[model samples]
Target chain A: DAGITQSPRYKITETGRQVTLMCHQTWSHSYMFWYRQDLGHGLRLIYYSAAADITDKGEVPDGYVVSRSKTENFPLTLESATRSQTSVYFCASRVGGSSYEQYFGPGTRLTVT
Target chain B: AQSVAQPEDQVNVAEGNPLTVKCTYSVSGNPYLFWYVQYPNRGLQFLLKYITGDNLVKGSYGFEAEFNKSQTSFHLKKPSALVSDSALYFCAVRDAGNAGNMLTFGGGTRLMVKP
Candidate 1:
């Protein structure tokens, strides 16, 4: 399909373990974003990439790393997961120019125990 | 910097009654506002957006939002509430000048519709 998709829709890992969430979009959108959704926080941006090799930090980027090696792929990695890091992660993409709305993926639910 | 606020944590409305979810935002440049609904265990779905032309924007599922620039509010509304309309609603804002495609989301409002 020509939509955004996230890998490992559900994941569980122990604290201090490293894990990665993969995001791929078939539309070849120039802008890809990673956001974490918590209980009280609707959605906080973790990282975003304007284009391949051009990434920037968002509101809550600490403890998370992201890279966009290809236009269709943007991966987020947690070096050492913590309980606080466990949340629903969403991947979104948007094409540049006149449109500003973003299309979101199904989301990945991560649990750190 | 851009920020969005959804004042009501939860809203209760009866089926066939009108419902409203409030949202306010602050941004440095021209504002691009959007509303999204998230069903349980699903990602956010884009509802409607207010870009430039009209102040009153109609969205999916018969939802509409009126953008009041002076008041800095984009409140979502529906003529008659439906049971299926109950979901977590979020309001997000992005500054038009922001080249990074960053959006600030509100805390979200849980809408409950009773039959």
Candidate 2:
């Protein structure tokens, strides 16, 4: 209840369909990040927000979209899901700055068929 | 460009034996290195970090890491491995001066401690 949480722990979506994964953190951290964990690639950052309304693309951001309208919420949306996008997505939050450690949510397992 | 490399895909150690998981990094500037562990179907848990100061950094669950700046390596080590310590280990790095503060993660190494 006091840590980060992700909705729809497991999801299945058809190719070309739009899907969104929600992440919420109760810690009121200033930094939120979205990462996709895939076989052989480890965890690659997709998006990160320094604060509300401030966001930037990470390594693999082409197929993903993210928004942070509120400090506690940072949702990732896939405009058109692809089979390649099927992976476990994780949401993380940090208090402030690059030196701080991040806390991760359970993760959302998304399968694109 | 900043990046992390975990050379070993898997590590096997007997219970009560010392363990080491290798990790090396490359960055344009000074790096902030970190180690995290992940159990089945769970999120990554912070292990330890090497920011500045002492080369040996102690972290959670009796895990420790030694930072060798010259070698650009930060290897995770633990004495007396336990069966419960078997999990996926990740190494990450961030540029100290970068404003974005995004982290680059290694491919990960699966540690299996046999009893």
Candidate 3:
């Protein structure tokens, strides 16, 4: 109930198509983050939002776009999905920043063909 | 740059024995270190953290970690391992002076406990 959630827990999209993954948190956390998890690379940040309308790029933000229209939502969009873009996406929320602990969502598994 | 290293890809421990998963970090200033656990097909869960104050921090599921600032290491340890404790453990650190809520995570270590 009062936890982070991601929509479409599993997704399969074709290459070059636009795909969006939704993330919502019930805690009204100020900071929301999107990360992609791969086999070799544990988890790489895609984008993060400090607050509503305040977004920042992370380590691997290319080809991805994110926006926080409200405190409870932070959605990630892939302009043109590729095979490399397919990975498990995780959404996390923190009341503050990294100085505080983060709570994560179940995660969305995406496969691009 | 800030980074975290989890040297071992996998760790094997027998039930009732002590267990340890090594982690080393590099940060600009005083580091905020954390350990998270993840079960198969699930999101990462908070385990323990060493922000300030104490060096020996105990966490959920009877797990504890010792922070060695001198060695830049914060290793997770459990006095007695359990079969249920097996999972993927990750060590992470935030970049110094930047409160971006961005954490650099290690590649993760798979812990397997044998009964």
Worst 10 residues of 2 chain A by lDDT: A94-103
Model 1 residue A92 lDDT score? 97
Q: Give lDDT: candidate 3, residue B34.
A: 90
TM-score of each: 0.96, 0.97, 0.97
Which tens-of-lDDT digit does each residue in B57-95 have in candidate 1?
999999999999999999999999999999999999989
lDDT of 3 by residue, B35-93 (tens): 99999999999998888888999999999999998999999999999999999999999
Tens-place lDDT per residue, model 2, A42-109, is: 99889999999999988899999899999999999999999999999999999985456888999999
Error of 2 at A97 (Å): 3.2
The true-versus-predicted C-alpha distance at residue A52 of model 3, in Å, is 0.4
Q: Which candidate, 2 or 3, has the higher DockQ?
A: 2
lDDT of 1 by residue, A45-110 (tens): 999998999999988999999988899999999999999998999999999887888999999999
Clashes in model 2: which pairs? none
lDDT of 3 at B26: 94
Give the least accurate 10-residue stretch of model 3 chain B, judged by summed lDDT: B94-103
Per-residue lDDT of model 3, residues A1-113, tens digit only: 76999998999999999999999999878899999999999999999988999999999999999988889999999999999998999999988744577889999999999
Candidate 3 local lDDT, residue B31: 86
Q: Which stretches of candidate 1 lie over 4 Å from their true place?
A: none
